[model samples]
Target: MQSDPHHDSANSVELPTPTAWPIITAFGLTLLFLGLVTTLFVSLAGFLLGLIGAIGWFGDVFPHPKHEPFPIRPHDEWPKDVCRVGRTVTHLHVGEHGHREQFPAAVHPYTAGFIGGLAGGAVMAVIACAWGYLVDQSLWYPVNLLAAAGLPELSTASTEVLKQFSLAGLVVALITHVTTSVLVGLLYTVLLPMLPAKREWIWGGILIPLMWTGLIWASLRFINPTLNARFEWLPFVISQIAFGMVCGFYVFRSTKVSTQQGWTVAARLGVEAQHPGEKKP
Candidate 1:
């Protein structure tokens, strides 16, 4: 028999094994989309299954009394120099005595993203006003178009008459535009935390905005005939792209996670920053 120098049964950790909850949740979402194309029964079934799967997944993600608290790997056990979660970067550093410490880049992203969206919307509104002034000779022309969604009569208002500000139109337009901006900002906060830090633009800027624009253009007539009739491709494209960039700005740079607690979160998320034995980091 070999003598052991280091052995501690009490401090030994207990981790959860691999789970199929994610697969189940994915299957549920797939059915939900399929239900959109098929029947209500199918959709309902999908929704129920997805809800169950999601609950299970969440349960698995959060710590349970059965599982031991997560333990950090020692300095010599680290696999990489850096690992990123959301926008937080965990730098694995070794000290003089070979003690390891994780330095995380901390930030608050949701508020920043919302603020960025508001700023971006203001910029877009200004640009729209400029376009209206130069081309239509009416500062109120752009706002009136948004107002026309609810007040159909504004669609046919003469340029001369529309040049003067319509209080109703301004109110409607501001409400419509600001609401859309806030919704998109909220979406950014949700999605940024779920995506890889390096591919922020791919999902946040290019893909999501492009997909949203296409959907909007395709459904414009059905969504709002008055606005559809007056849609201009140039300004629409510019504004969408600008909005995405501005939204991506805050989401990419401002999200943060504490390295210690974040390690467990990253592990649960199946991010590349997980510990060596469980998965590749």
Candidate 2:
């Protein structure tokens, strides 16, 4: 007979239910915002209340066990089970106690960033090829620029001089583009998680790309003067903006964790706690 791992009857431990710490913390934050216009003592009171509530809230959310708990590494470090889903693990088929279990923590940012970066790089490469074809009637034109920039013989050739497509150039351009795209994607993932969730599209997708475009434009002379001279300013600018937006979208979508899960998990634990011997509904 097959064992029902999902419904373990041997182990039964109830967990604490959600308390009012989060609500209290929200109110404290509201007071802190209003304190800027109100009296000094009001702000002080808000701060104190916020601090206490935050401590209580965290304790309530993840209560410390009387006995030492087993140390579980971040989700990224855990071994993959039957599911091919890299770090966004939903279940551990067989845990330390030899039973099915839910993943202890949420997905890591680095994992999300890596995936986002690859996606962004692919989109950027497609855009580059399309833009190059539109301008020069040949996809090899811009790629050749990247190759020519590295090779002095090709670099010295006049704009009028047309050389055969360079395999070396294609390779160089692809590597450079992918490396830069992945780095930018990783940066977006790191910053997005820490930042307040507001006006994300404008700040992440538009403003950041604009800033990167200007920086690249300014540094072109040092990076590759020949390529700088060869590059069409408008197409390059548009491509960079497109890359940023695509990368931001992927990063934003991948790294989100819902607070609702916390409540659900807590509620499940509460049920288990209330009826340790009975099967959970």
Candidate 3:
């Protein structure tokens, strides 16, 4: 004698009826786009399928949405282990020290990151320029390589052309270099704090640069064929290390501002006082 699943259930929920119209409509849309590269007949078939699906979907919802009643079994029918409730939640007061373990309790300000980035970028630029001068006897060579990723004209340029200075390449390189430097600097502020303070330099300056350098080496051909064809790995790795060290050190030295994790909503929003003795900002 098997008992009915919903025998003890008194309440039921009316959930939306499952239908195949949506699948048909999606298939039609896929075919419609596929037809652009195939034939008009495929497109016509897709349109017909889409129209029929849309009409059927609309019919299911227009006058009154179609729904199916789902009976919920009583709690007694549930497995004993699943039915057991966990311990009650305890709420912590805001700004209460040592209440919970919060990571990155503070962080360096954006201004610090910005300044660090500029400093790092300057150092990186100097190293890159020095590499170009030493290797190719042309200061413009490295800058041209950096810009070659974005500028189509430079992609196929000869080694002699790459050594020659171009105004367009200089502008592109400057923009790309500054933007990347600043973003990475800001990232350091967030990431370095999460690492062990005693060995942050090892992770940020050495390990991180090596890891990303390897990644870039692997993907450079796809990202920039022109640069990949003429990439000097040792110089690139050195520059990356210099940038990371400079940026990480600057950010680590900067004063850290407390996070808003311990602040109440009102305090965070500056709408009301956080504590009884505190004044609203």
Candidate 4:
């Protein structure tokens, strides 16, 4: 047996494992590389998206903007139901209300919508029909393209028809978003159900008459921008109550059986149905 030399030193220090340093260094480098790659990717995507958006906006856009929120419980009402529910949302969340609720986004978009009444309401003051005409042009461009490519129904007269549709859709979407956004929170959520308790639609999907036939009335009787006298404040107020009884009744009529994915439901009588995952109170 070989004898060890000085094996009983009182102040000996143990050495760390050799592989630990390399592993730690490798982890740090990997984190740094991942951060760099993510940053670069985001920057590139943002730049490309901005460039494309700018090009599209250079001329015009129909602005068929629509957005819907995830319902308080949305799973109960999608995928297959063809019915409608709910009504036009006229109010949006404003700062004061949100401060009270301690919510994010500063605004509740449910009824008020994405743009609400802001974009067009601002643009209309400065540009007049130029914006409207551009909007009209945008709405119909798809149809014109189809026609130009020789769609059987519209190959010959696609341009004229497309122009009309563009003009109409632009007029409608803009007015709807704006008039609704002018308020202070969603009026209500629209829903359409297909069964007593099975499926529902989040937005009711009603193409409520937003600005139909009323623009001419407003311009002729309301706005006088040259004299600086338009129904500038009136359109905002006129749309306040967003109640179309027709729509209300239609949505109410479409109720379905509220299932697990839908609203809280009970049976048809005095007895209560136990919730899937709850214990008796």
Among these predictions, the greatest TM-score belongs to: 3
Clashes (backbone N, CA, C under 3 Å), per candidate, total: 0, 1, 0, 23
Local error of candidate 2 at residue 205 (angstroms): 1.1
Which candidate ranks first by lDDT, i.e. highest?
3
**lDDT of all predictions, in order shown?**
0.71, 0.66, 0.82, 0.35
Q: Would you give me the overall lDDT of model 2? A: 0.66
Candidate 1 lDDT over residue span 1-281, tens digit each = 01221332454545554688889899988999999998978889989999999999888767642244346567588687775656854544442321233332233456876887787688778878888888778888888877877776676676555677999889989999998887788778666656766777777777777888899999988766766877788877777777887877766677464344334556658775654432112
Backbone-clash count (model 4):
23
Q: Write the per-residue lDDT of candidate 4 for residues 1-281, one digit (tens) a residue.
A: 01222332333322222333334444444554565768766555555555555544432322421222222335555377666767764443432222222222222224232232343233332233333245444444432322233233333443455455544444544455355433311232221222233332222222222332245345533222221222233422223213322233333443222222211246224256733332111
lDDT of 2 by residue, 196-230 (tens): 76867676777888888888788888777777887
Model 2 regions more than 4 Å off: 1-108, 160-163, 195-197, 256-281
Native-structure RMSD, model 3: 9.9
Better of 2 and 3 by lDDT: 3
Off by over 4 Å in 3: 1-87, 90-104, 265-281
lDDT of 3 by residue, 106-210 (tens): 668877788888888889999999999998899999999999999988888999999999999999999999999999888888887777767888887888878
On TM-score, the stronger of 1 and 4 is 1
List pairs with backbone clashes in candidate 2: 14-273
RMSD of each: 18.3, 22.2, 9.9, 25.2
